[model samples]
Structures are given as structure tokens and as C-alpha cells.
Target: MAKADITLRGRNYSIACAPGQESRIVALAGQLDARLQHIASAVGDIGEDRLLLISALALLDELDAARRTARPSPEMERKMAEALGAASDRIEALAARIESGG
Candidate 1:
């Protein structure tokens, strides 16, 4: 395990992660802190817990929007389906030829 110190809202917290994941954890904490700061600026000095809550909700909203937009479109889905169907047909034909001892 690895330990890292992260600062958020002017407070320091120690976090532990897998040996190689410390950098990733630190980076994510930075993102969270940035979001917290942004929220605090907009709604001046609403308690820490409230600020954290709002930041978490805001981050989740952003994640949901990204997921929705990143999903495969209808055209992409159609192309994938066509590709899979072609591969399946080739496999079945190969199996049939083997069964016939040719």
C-alpha cells in the first residue's frame, strides 16, 4: 500500500492506495479540491459538509453527462453488429467444413 497526503479546502488528509496508484489518487483529490473551490466561490462559505456535498453532486452530474455523450451512437452500434455477424458466419462455415472432413 502507498500513503499520500491530499489537501482540500485548506485541510490535509492522508489517503492510502495500491503502491502504484498514489499519483492517480492525488490527481483525483486535486480535481475534487478544484471543484470544491469553485462551489465555495459561488456560494460563499456554506459549511464544509455542505460544500463537499454540493461538489460531489456536481462531479456526479458531470460524470453522468459524459457517460451519456460517450455511449455508442446508433450508427456505431449498427457497424459493430454487422462486424460481429460477419465473424460469427465465418466461424460457423469453418466448423461445418471441418465436420465434413474437407
Candidate 2:
């Protein structure tokens, strides 16, 4: 296993990942942190847990919108659906971790 140290909302976390996935995990964390910062700026510091929940919902809304508007061939649609499913799973896992105070 590999571990990536990520900072979100000014706090650091060590995330475990498969070998060779550390950079990908760090990059995803950076994107998430950026979104969290933007949400915080708009809503003010309403606590990390709330901010995270809001961010997750906002992301899901965007994804849903995109899915509705996207038009692709059957093969491409299959690939996109698979990718979205993976992303959803990851989001659920992250939410569970946050809920558990991990």
C-alpha cells in the first residue's frame, strides 16, 4: 500500500491507496480541497463536516446535470457509466470515513 498526505480545510490526513496511486489520490484531494475552500468562502466556516457535506452534494448535482446533457455512442455511454459508478462509490466511502471521524 501507498499513503498520500493530503490537506483539506487546513487539516492534514494520510490516505491509503494502492501502490502507484499516491499521486492520483493527492491530486484528487487537491481538487476536493479547492472546492471546499470555495464553498467555505461563500458560506463562511460552518464547520468541516457541514462544508464537506455541502461540497459532496454540489459535486453530485454537477455530475447529475452533466449526465443528463451528455450525448455519446453506446460504447462511450457504457464507459461513462462505469466511471460514474466508480466515482459514486468513492464518494460514498469518503462520506462514511468522515462520518466515522477518520
Residue pairs of candidate 1 with colliding backbone atoms:
none
Candidate models: Cα lDDT each: 0.92, 0.93
By lDDT, the best candidate is 2
Top TM-score hit? 1
lDDT of 2 by residue, 1-102 (tens): 789999987799999999999999999999999999999999997988899899999999999999977868899989989999999999999999999999
Lowest lDDT sum, 10 consecutive residues, model 1, at 51-60
TM-scores for the candidates: 0.82, 0.66
- Over 4 Å off, model 1: 90-102
Give the clash count for each candidate: 0, 0
